[model samples]
Target chain A: MPTTLIGLDGVPYGLITSYAEKGYLPNIASLIARGEIVQMESTIPDVSSTAWSSVITGANPGEHGVFGFFDIDRQTGRLCFPQFSDIHVSPFWEGKKAAAINIPQTYPARIENGLMVSGFVSPTVEKAVSPAGWLEKVRELDYRIDVDSSLAQESMEKFLDDLYAVLDSRMRLFRETRDAEKWDIYYFVFTGTDRINHFLFDAWDDESSEYHKPFVDYYRKVDECVGEILSTLKPEEKIYIHSDHGFCPLEKEFYVNRWLVEKGYLEFATDSPALITDMSPSSKAFSLDPGRIYINAKDRFPNGSVGTGDREKIKAEITEKIMRLESDSVCPVARVADGCEVFWGPVSSRGPDLVFLGRRGIDIKSLVAVDGLFGKRIFRGMHTQDDAFLIAGQKENLPSPFHVSRIASLVV
Target chain B: MEYLDYLENKSIYVIRESYARFKNMALLWSMGKDSTTLLHLCMKAFMGKIPFPVIHIDTGFKFPEMYEFRDRTARRLGLDLIVAENRLAKYRGMGPNKAGASKLECCNALKTESLQQIVAKLKIQSLLVGIRRDEHGIRAKERYFSARDESFKWNYTDQTAEPWDYYRSLERDGTHFRVHPILHMTEADIWRYISREKLEVIDLYFAKGGKRYRSIGCAPCCEPVESSASTIYEIILEIESSKTAERAGRAQDKEDAYTMQKLRSLGYM
Candidate 1:
């Protein structure tokens, strides 16, 4: 019997019953019927890089080194992605020959002795690995492909037309490749469902109050795609459908950074303007990036230095300040264990001496005189701290929903 | 075929969804692992072909190697690359060195403005990004299909509810949408996928002189972390035990409390 695994990005298990009942996903429902589907608990941070890493490596965030999408360099204070070369562990696929295609958040198409296709949102051809030899031959036989969006709306349609033509050709290429390649493993990814959900969510509702249509159309299309793939698959293959996490609506927006500044945990230079001209300034400063913050300890103190003793004091002070701020309802803050929940801590060398979590409905705002800092209004449609789903083959032998860490064990 | 098969399937699903739904779309490629992986997914969705153009907003301060890798990859992948720049800021000789502006403002000038101009010029109706909800507090609240108005404002309060896979697109007023294909994924899954697929990612991720890129961004703004794990296996071990955030090396995020949130609200990628 042949084995096939299908991974669905961001397919929340919570809504599967409803979607399946509505006939929006018969293929998925049938697969679930044949197999057991369970909610898989995600990592503490629940971020993609971290979660995906855990899923593939069967490890936690502490083991993957991918805490978030952007991390500060300790020495240079620059932000960057943890590259493949930076990885310190071996993934299960290291020795296995497999055809890997477009896994979001893992770039450069790193499959050996098998085909590799990149994902969406990557930079143009000028920024990706070139297809060589057999891949190039495949490209030639495929339709003309050009992935470029013009700067003008008038030319936008042309871009889409070109895109569609390429897509059609590539679909053909996929069929050809799959049929010709007699391999033990094959992998593929798609982002259309996510795109539609983000853009047209508001179009479906008669209430005209919330974003709606994009998700509906996207899933409908996904269902169709699934149907097509199912028709092409053999009975012996095992299909696994899953998502990274779940989704929710945004109720409110809170500017946590501004709240932090107001609460006094963070301080800035009074002598000079809050903004600095040089990349590396000599003045005191405080800034926020999502849930984390950074303080210029060297420039803030009179002596311009933060000693080890001072580090403890600063940590205590910052923690107390953040806790107080959380109590005051200025922002949503939570204390999480090191590898258990989302908490504030060092991200890299230049990370904020302290970190905080902005509650689900809250959006952090800074009082700094930046272009978008002030006068920013509230937003709707938010994310939630929920465990996503992982459906492996038939539901009979799946792991518990809460124990997502065990997903690798199932496959291995 | 075990874990790698699962990772590949999920990514392909996201790529196809993005292609079929949004009429006008583009991608944000920072030349980093996550975004680059997203790019690779696009090709896979189309079966070894990418249908959409890829955008790279050059802030002129990226590491020299990043640019080299960018060019080489573009040539190799046969990508339609669109380079967006903040011409006005560049003309004014603006950079991270401007003292009056906070790191947040610097990002606005270099990244936000460049992205806005590119969107306007391209008339992009939707943008496919590689952001994950687990990355940050504010990001944790984001939807798979996030909407943005004409001025690129993100109204988190009035967002539509996505009950399960039934997402609501077509905003009443927004000109574009921000799509997150990997919102539900965790940090560990990404690493696992990379390892399982043997994906070719940027070399900077590995430790250099006992340091590695915990997260990547601009040259002057991003930083690395201390680690002895130079190989992928060792790095995984370090991550499993560390307590640091991913952006610890980034300087701009430390300028204010809500720096990233503010920048994101203004359409900063």
Candidate 2:
């Protein structure tokens, strides 16, 4: 079967379901009627890069060895962002001929049984696509692989312009390239939803807010792209519309490492280095973005004092402390998943000791030298679990919280 | 009169100003089209003989033709050239192809640290580079004239804004400024300038067999794109008509979301 999967990053079932219910997203509404709509569970850290890697390869974070967006190199103790080459297992469609575009973290564009055009986080458009000349074709369609994100943070008008521009060019390129090539499977992702949601999500429901129009306007553009992709679907072809993860709004930053310091777990001598990885040798624990807590075990960090045998005990203590620690202004940390259970793979040891899940309104930072526990965020949106939407054409019954890797099966 | 002419005039003006502002100023020549073109602009700005020397940080992994071009061009132009290499690091087995390190680490060990070493030793108050805003996302965030601390770290978040070409060149005694003479030029404008000036481009740029180098870096770290445009006119047509990023073939930028930003922060051009 020639399946088409369109990934809408950071969109939840509630927004799509409600909007589709009201006729705002007609294609999605129709897909729900004829297909299965289920909420999906993204990877534990729930970062876009790792989530998309899981979606590409049917393996979990442990199996794939991609734990988070950025990982700490166990040997060098350096903060390293994982790339396409870092993927441990062969991608799900490794052998099959496929066409994938605008998928994040698939940089240095992989050349396998088909074409791949890596999107955001890709260094250059030339290296962003495979088979060489397809890059020219993508550019010819006026596609912008990476949006000028500074505009989104600085100016709303420019942000909307850039959002629509990317959508239009992406739609044109996807359609043009889909017909231009023949493949067993064609996959595309619309990231503007995630970008727009981050900046204008608070104004999404507020009609009086200045950002309300741009919010709905961007969604309408996404809806139009989905509709266009749907309208061109072959009679025998079935499309899978889904999101990597769900979106939530965050008002304040939760400084996890600072909290760890407050609890006397992590220590620093001279705070010359600004990052968590630069902590002093005696430091027992540290944190990374999106609330990942790592115990600086002897073997893990260069000069870590905590031993491997004591890993479990330290993790347990940190988990309890993190769960109990909360600020009045910040949303409480609801659930903490042990890193051992959360991450499993050859490189899983490099992952954090605990993966902290914040309440809806909370977000985590990896700051080691923060001024205080409470800090306002420049951007408003964040990632949430159990909010990802997956609509498949198969008649088989699916679980409400379908796994992200399950979509990898439909790609082939 | 043309876009290229406007860009060239702006670059010439910027180059002259940097020469006037700092007694210790040098242009970084990477032996690539952009830097080679910048060299030609320097020759034009200084009336056939650049007053200051040129610096080229050799990572020891460059294409053989690059070294040839560097020596030949310097000799022919009667220019003072200083070739720098981190031989100690390379001898100790530090390379882009080395295992256990990410792309950016290799770049820092070979490029950024090497440049910083030379800059501090030479005490160059300002270094002129041929960086354009459209090259990469990180480059887009830069000003025409950027400053770096004693450690060669660029404070990207707290960068000062420039109005009417007023570059804030003042910095602490140990600190230095990076004067970008071609920050406003586009990739197309660069090709146009090269074509108009009749500058000699490296042979790697012209297509041979089936591939051509778009952005030249170290041999192990750089890859070539598929292009049939062997001549200057064909290259110009290929570039102006296509939207592929020029530095896409360069491998260092793929390390992460902020690899280039980190490299620039650590003092890599």
Candidate 3:
């Protein structure tokens, strides 16, 4: 029997379960009743690229090798976005007859037998799909990989409209593809949940909020689409539903690179340093978005200063210090793990030396030239490591200590 | 980024945290792939030297090859190795082959008791274990830092929540913590790391006449699986596509669904 996986990106366990229980998502509620649902853990950095890579590879960052959206190019000492090819392991459906649609971090999709349409980070529809012939059809269907999330900053109404339009296009693509192709495994991810959550998550449960109805209404429409999709599944076939990571209310943005400068761990040669490469040779450490810290080791970076022997001490000292970081009685960092311990594989040696897991309400970011230790952002919500959910068709087969890395095994 | 570096950094962090938190801490070395990789991590964390002692529970039934590998590796790594053995059990004729002893009973007497003796002797407050969640179902529930009470009984029912790396380092009186730095790593990861770091392991892991040991323990309790993977690269390749569990060759876990849990709760590493 063919297995179908419907990914509702960024939908948290509490939000979906509560919504399903309260009659806002009847289709999902019925699905939950027929299966099992639980809180699933995301990757350490808890970003879309890392979590989705884990989902496809069925391995931790150590095995799959993608730590975050961005990584320091060891040879150049320059930061670069890790693309689909950066993932080390063979995707779960490497040899299987499969159809993957709108899955994030899968830009420049590769498929042999069936179809594929990459999700986020995909610059153009022509380059995102396999079976190149599908390009014209995808464009004709008005398919969009992701809504311009930045639009929410200027106009919430236009952003909501974009979300609905993108979701509608996604449903159209899903319906058209399901009818056009038959495969052993079929996976389609709806990224609208994430786009809406990032902007309007605060509206949740607050009936008085201006955008509350639009927020809930978006999910209601999502429920109707989910029902339409489920109606296509065979009774004997399995299905899996999950999110890459959870969403949380963002209270403040912690400028990590700026914090490093204030703490004297980092030094920028230029006052208006827009890139980490502008860091002085004496700089000890730097940070990346969603809290990844890398030591400017002499062996790795061209302008490195920290010696190999001193790297550990500095990392431990920073880890201890970052754990105590606070602002207005709120500890920004929940934990700071030494990166080496969390990842292990052939390519792991180039990962960050330290990774910070932020506390709820704090979004850890790395804008190199930011002025202060903390700032507010246009984004109202952020990603969380825990609370990302998985609703499995066959609970008996779900991997224990449930994690996103093990999600692919349930289907492939 | 390389996944190994991430795991190495995290392991190093956990190691440093344990060292900073506890007055007396030690790492349990089994000469197995997991523990040996952990020893590498410990050494890397401390900058080419482990600040704490490395304890090995010599169960007497371990393979001669393992003993050789252990001694050679300890000396090579300059480890302050302390071999813990339950001589009293050996003297009393308690063994896996003994008429009245089950494999589990023998393990408790030989391995667990030996470990307990060493812990008491050293008054160690924290122990670094190389247990991974992917090893067995029971281990999947373990936190990075887990506690055992006065009698060394693991309260598996009430584990402290370890969200991210914010591990609970505190313990009550008469309790000690078991720190797992590699709890998130998988079997495939261990082999892949072994390849990446080029760490030495016992030759028993390699295939002999189409048989290879996937996991190493007591000589009698551990069986070699049918395979032709003689090199570390081959092992990684084997692990990536292998359908069998990592511990499928070990005997104790085969006794029942809860055998490992029972053993672990009773202080077995």
Candidate 4:
């Protein structure tokens, strides 16, 4: 049977259940009644870049070797965004007749069997699609990879309108593609969910907020899209709906590198350090975005002091010390693990030495130029490891807990 | 890297990572072929010197040769050995023959509980377990870094994904992780590694009267399989051709199909 997999980035299980129960999402409610929604665990350093890779490959980071949204060069200690090419393993659709539309980290798309369209990071629609001829059709449909996220900071009305516009064009593209092509698997993703969550998560529960109604309407439209897609599928066809990760209302942004500085674990050569590569000779450790800490081992980094023998001692000391850190009488640092413990495989040595998971509502960052240990930025929502939901097409009693790594099995 | 080099590097990376992550961590040394291989990897990872204590959960029912090998290896490697035994349980004479007790109960009271007590006393945040997925069906479901609650209950129901080497080493209150460095290595890989590295193992693994223990545990529970493999080379050759399960000779595994799952869910390393 042909399979259809739908991805709604950053949609939480609780939100779907609650909204469906409240009659705000009748389509999703029918799926819930017909089958069931199970909470799925996302990848560590939970982000689209890592989680989507897992979903496509059906393999863990140790096997696929893509650790985060950004990876550090082992020799240079310079930061670089990891692309789909950086992924070590071929996706499940390697030899299948599949159409993967708008999946993140898949820029400069390639599909040997069927159609391919890259996601948000893709520069333009022209460059995002393979088989170059699809470009003209995509442009004709006004197909946009993502909503202009910066518009939220400028004007909420324009941002909301753009969100609806992009989602509308996405649905149109889905219809145009699905009806025109014959494939064994059709994978479509809505990145607008994550964008709306990042800027308007607080508006979701707060009825008094101006954007609350618009937020609910955005999801209501998604439900309509899902219903429409289901209507086109044959009775014997399979369907699976899931998200990369869940979302939570952001409380405070924890600047991890600043905290490291306060604890004397990191030192910057300049008072206004711009990046991790600017660390001074005395610097023992440094962190990248989303709380990935790497030790500046003398054997590895150019300006380093901590030797290979001292990595364990230093990591343990940091783990203990980081647990004691408290902000507003609450511990934001949830868990800390050494690099090898979190990652393995050939390229794992290029990964961070320690992975720090923040508690819910606390967004962690590793920007070296932050002024304080904690602060609020433009984001009103944060990514969470738990609470992502999956509604399997041919539901059965799964032998193990659901995770993004196993999501590929649902369709491919 | 070569296949053996790959396995060695992965194991060394895990060993180093766990040591760095958990300051109060220790390696579980069962004096078995797998754990002894793990011990060698630990020394290699830490630059010819093991930085942490190596624990041996003594059930007091081990073979004499196993004990001899343990002491000899510990002294030779200069390892900080901790012989963790439930002296109270041993003193109370708990064994398979205990009244109304099944082999499972004896194992829980002795092996599992002994490991639990040592972990609690030492406040170990992480424990290096030498388990391979190829060894059991349930172990095949385990993560490289698996977590257990304060009461030492393995939450096999809700394991997080480990994609591209990023393991879910989330720190929760009163939760400890079981780091499995060799989980990906197969039985054949282990023997091949042993042969290549020339690592020493207990003599029991070699054929004794055309019989050898494929997997070792407590003396009463473990049995030898019919094999004429007298050296590491022969063992490697045997592993390539042998279709028998590795734990077939262990009575504990034969108790029931789900017995290991049940034991593991209750934190049996």
Candidate 5:
């Protein structure tokens, strides 16, 4: 029997424990009861692309060189959105047949064996799946490779409706593919769980929240899907149910760029959309998504100011400052490690010098169009540092303090 | 020295390359500024006459002026025009008027399905489309010359690489390709080119009662955004200051999270 890995993209462990405690998710509760649970840890930034790659390749961000959805080339000072093709190492199931579906950051879909339907951020539809024949089979089911959730900015109702429709279609696709293919390993990921949390997470805590029932109802559907998929697995086959990272209700959006400007570490040439290269010559440091700080060392950037001897001082100072940060709606920063400290291998020089992690509820951002620290937020949920857990029935040689990357090897 | 000239030159380069590469080629004319600009580039590419046919995947629900302008321009330019529609699909119940499902369903039925049928019917090996990267998030990741399988499915992630003005491997064994002459151009570039070429445009783009269609699809799904731009120059100025994305007014894209991706995969224009 083949191992089946069911990834609930961003459904937190805490959410699952609570839902199971209340008997809302009996299937998940039963899995926790049987499978050995390992508190799975995500990457430093805990982005979908990097975390998923880690799980696929059985390596750290240091080894795989995918820090986030995007990467900045230190040589040219140009930013590049890295894709699945950028993964240096082959996946754990290399040369083995596996049916992979809807996994985020796996676009430009590739597999040595088996079929792959690339998930989010795919550029085109034809290339998202391999062996051109599989394209129509997936298309006929009205299967969408991704959801254009940008519409949610204006209409939440349409967003929710589409999410539900996608969920139902996903279940249909899963069963269709499962029955059709004979594979050694099967993998499927659902991104709707993350999208729902981003929009209606406030409802999770507040029963009176307007979309409360819809939110809970969505989980119930997820629960039903889990049960259906799990029941199909044979007694000998193993199952792994997990999420990439946890989530908490978001309140204030903290603009780290604004903080840098206020502290006189960064100076902008102009406003509007602030690019990293827009920093003035006198600027000492700049940053990118999810709290990545790069010290503008002498000769490093075109407008580099900070020297070699002064980098550690600058990194230490900013680390302390960001760590102590707290405001009315924002919680205190939990961990503020240097980028080099967080990621290792060849990506150190190309990566950030400082990586900061803030507590959940305060959404973190690098760009600031306005001259302020706090800003308006459209989203209600934010990624938390305390990531979710992974439960698997196979109990051979598990790392006592295992990371999520090890999950791929456990099945192999 | 003008930016518009550089844009025209680049677009002309793409158009010439597409013409030289593929045999069974056609161009898409949406009767909008982007596709109209593409036509202008096509004329320039072949020196005053386009050798290939221009295709318009008509849904039969466009603005009246669109039809009028399309006919007027097609006659004026002496274009080898071919209008493709899935009338059978429409007769079998499509369009927003036949609403039980989403407007997206109608799009899939009437627009995407129709185009796929027409292309296969013509045995079109390639199409010269006017898709810009800035139009939608899904479009942002498209290749200059994108291939679709026999099923007309676009693989967004698994696309071919373009290196130094060279798009490798002109044809595939079991797939057709779409050639985007203006994939790199922005919304602002289209207006600038329209001004430079003195091209005729759909009147819906200009402000009427303090609003204009930033993006034109079908009459029912398209909405006009608040604008004061009355001329091409003013529209360029609007593009410079506009905060909203060009496709924000297109309703079908917002029907679900991935409607655009799904539509594009199914060969929707």
Candidate 6:
């Protein structure tokens, strides 16, 4: 008997009920009939990097140190991602010999011994080592490599055609690898579904939209791939499928950061030419170091200088002003935290003097700085902080949160 | 079954379901941990065979290593690779430095526009991506099999009901469904699976010169964070208890509030 694990990017259990009931996903329905389904509690913020890090490390965000999608460096006042090199904990893969394919957002592109495939949004060769062995195989199969975004329209079509071919090719390669090599574990990932959702979520309706037929057709195509994999599976092999979290519809847009700026918690330079061109009375600055404000003291003040005495007074005044606006519903300004604790580094290098968190139901829009935070049209959908779903092939022998740390323990 | 077991099981089931459902689907490869891990899962689901094409959208501004890694991994995995780029934008000299367009515009031209064109050209209905709700406040509202309009706009107010273990795949008219296979697992579960499976991963994750790529992106936009942890184990430990965001190194994100949301709304992946 063989053990196989298939992970999805964002397949929520709740969303699958319709497909199963309607027989859209018969294989999955059959799996459910034979197995137990469970809900997995996700970490706070539930961001991909942090959640995935936790999954690999079997630790919490507090333990993994991957808090959000972005973080401010306490020392240099720079924003950064939590890289594997920056992590101090051990992942189960470190002890086992396995092949990993298509992991997103990971850098350096170096793995222990097994084969490796990077994901989208990753850095290029200058930023990380090239897995030439993998590249050669793909190229031999006539895979396309896009070096620039110059011929976007033409390139996109080419990309799509190539994507379909690659999926088939990769599946064939997997079968070959399984037959040619004797390995304990092997893994690969697919991201077409998530991409479709991000761009075509609105196209899956009954309306006479140009993307309607194409979206439906794509789903059917993906279904065929699922069937193909099932057909090739050994009878005794255990198959497990899952996702990081579910999707939701978006609606209203809010500029929480802009609200903070209006409240005077965050101060900007008025004299600098760049600042003059960029900053509007309604514009807001976004900082990962919540509650910390970076004040250009030298250029912001009327006398071409901001004295320490004046800076302290301004900081104090801003804190008070923000506190007063915390409960205002129209404005998304939540309570402002103390900068001294929220921001790190010397007073000069740290972020804003004040940090703000939006109240529930408020999501700051990215256009706040350029378009002025207020008065933007509302979006139809939004995200939620819900627990993700997990289903196991063998109910009794599945992994648990408490035993998460033991995943590597068992594999190694 | 334990939470981890349940997560793994669900992910595998979703992957298989996706393979079974879509006839002409492709996996979007960003060369990131999540998507890379997703590729691994596809192999596992098929017992070493990835049954779909791998698509990479080249914005022409990605870090050089990303291209190298993409080429290397695709070849090694024997994957059918498709590289998409917005030639119009590139030829027009569209880049991060453009003044009027802002970062969101830049992404639209390079990423969103390119993706839209690719999907239309390939007539791709199902696209597999590695998006996690926890990654962004707006992402939390997404559905596993989400519906999209022809123009690719996401309608949050009117969403279909999603019960347990069932999804809505067949769309009336010409609409399409977005499938997410790993919507249940968390960052911890992914790492645990990677470790347990001893999956091979990228090396930029490790620190260099007391600085590590907290997140890897374009050379001009992506920056490193100061860290002393040199090994994966050490990196994992640091991740378990950090208060930073993963995309801190990406400059576009800091351009303003809701920058990501705006880009996403405009169809930027």
Chain A vs native chain A, TM-score per candidate: 0.73, 0.94, 0.96, 0.95, 0.92, 0.67
- Considering only N, C-alpha and C atoms within 3 Å, which residue pairs clash in candidate 2? A62-A344
lDDT of 1 by residue, A1-412 (tens): 3344555554556566567777778887786777767776665554444556666556555445665545544444444445432433334343234454445445434444455554432322222222344555555655332233221123433533444455455456557656556545555554433323222323333335343443454466666666666677766665666666554333344454445455554444453334321223332334433344445556333323454456556556666665665333443555412221332222223224444444554434333444322233323333233647766655556546555445544444
lDDT tens digits by residue: candidate 6, A1-412: 3445454554445555545666666666677777855555444343455556556556545445555445544433333444554443344453234455544444435554455554433444323223466665654554322112222234444534544665666566555445443334455555554445444445555348676666555555665666555566676666555555554443344554455455644444453312222333232333332223444354332222355656677667656665565333554544554545532211212234454543434433433243455443323222233435565556645544322222333333
Chain A TM-score, candidate 5?
Answer: 0.92
Instruction: State the lDDT of candidate 3 residue by residue for A68-179, as single tens digits.
Output: 6666665446545566755766577654577899898886677655799998767556768887989899999988777866566678888888888899899889888996
Give the better candidate number (4 or 5) by lDDT. 4
Q: What is the lDDT of residue B95 in candidate 4?
A: 90
lDDT of 5 by residue, A1-412 (tens): 5789999987877788788888888888888777666666777777677788888877767656777665544444544456676674457665356888888878678664578888876766777886667888888888876555665776888888888888888887898888677677898888889888877888985898889888998898888898999889877787888888778888777788889988889887776654655667788887776777789888566467898999999999888777666687344566777766677653345567877677666766776565678775567887765656677755544554457777776676
Better of 2 and 3 by lDDT: 3
Better of 1 and 4 by lDDT: 4
Per-prediction DockQ, in order? 0.01, 0.03, 0.03, 0.02, 0.01, 0.01
Model 1 reaches what TM-score against the true structure? Answer: 0.51
Looking at model 2 chain A, which ten-residue stretch has the lowest summed lDDT? Answer: A88-97
Candidates 2 and 5 compared: the better one by lDDT is: 2
Task: Please give, as one word, the docking class of candidate 2.
Answer: incorrect
- DockQ, candidate 6, comes to 0.01
Winning model by lDDT: 3
Query: Model 4, residue A374: what's the lDDT?
Result: 84
**Chain B: TM-scores of all predictions:** 0.85, 0.87, 0.88, 0.88, 0.87, 0.83
| Decoy 4 TM-score against native | 0.61
lDDT of 2 by residue, A1-412 (tens): 7778888988988788878887877777888898879888888888777789889877777656776656676555666667786675556554346788888778768754578888767767777888786777777877787556667546778877888888878888877877765566788898888877777677767789988877876787788888888887888887888898888777766777778888888877665556666678888887776677778888777678899898888888887766666477443787898877777654465567788888887777666656787676456777886689899865658877898878876554
- Candidate 2: where are CA atoms >4 Å away? A269-273, A329-331, B1-269
